[model samples]
Target: MNRLAYQYVVLRCVPRVDREEFLNVGVVVYCQAADYLQVAWQVADDRLRALHPALDVDQVRDALGFIEGVCAGDGRGGAAAGHPVGQRFGFLKAPKSTVIQPGPVHGGVTTDPAAQLQHLLGCLVG
Candidate 1:
């Protein structure tokens, strides 16, 4: 299989932006040639609580769910709905000042974007 270029961003949870602290919570991977865009996430509740006991884990999960919705082009994507894979990815990776945000964009080559997503999620977020 021919390798294809892919772009990705690590999803981060900034419990306190003022302190410039964040927790890696997920990953978004986009492989245009493969028509693939997806996310793999795992919220470490204990770790997040250690960071900010007042932080709402449910809310964080909800934000992550919205990302999943955007990837699927479903109702959860809200204004991002109806967009193609690349556009959806752009929306997800856009800079934001919120509890859930994306890290810097990165690139790599992959034969399976799905597997790559998992690996990155583990390496970067897990």
Candidate 2:
């Protein structure tokens, strides 16, 4: 199978930004050449509570849900729904100061981005 260039970012939940602590909640992969974009997420609630017992995991899940919507073109709340795959990925990967944030941008080559997304989520967030 021919490989295509891809870029990805680790989705993080920073309960507290000042202390710089975060938990990996998901992975977003974008393969421009393949016109593919998707996200795989596993919310470690126990780990989230470990960071801060008062942390609101539902809020995190809600935020992540929007990302899932963006990837699927579900048009949830009309956020980045009609944009190109690359633009949608750009919107998802943009940095934010809120509870859910994206880590540094990273790149690789993959023949199967969807499979690679699951693999990365398992490795990074599990």
Best lDDT among the predictions, by candidate number: 1
> Would you list the clashing residue pairs of candidate 1?
none
The backbone clash count of each candidate, in order, is 0, 0
Candidate 1: count of backbone clashes, pairs at least 3 residues apart or interchain: 0
- Model 1: per-residue Cα lDDT over 1-126, one tens digit each: 989999999999999999888999999999999999898899999999999999999999999999999998889879886898898999999999999989999999988889899889879987
lDDT of each: 0.92, 0.90
Query: lDDT of candidate 2 vs native?
Result: 0.90
Off by over 4 Å in 1: none
Predicted candidate 2 versus true structure: per-residue lDDT over 2-121, tens digit per residue: 999999999999999998999999999999988899998989899999998999899989988888899988867265877888889889889899999999999999899888998999
After superposition, candidate 2 runs with Cα above 4 Å error: none
Candidate 1 C-alpha error for residue 117, in Å: 0.7
Worst 10 residues of 2 by lDDT: 75-84
| Alpha-carbon shift of residue 25 in model 2 (angstroms) | 0.6
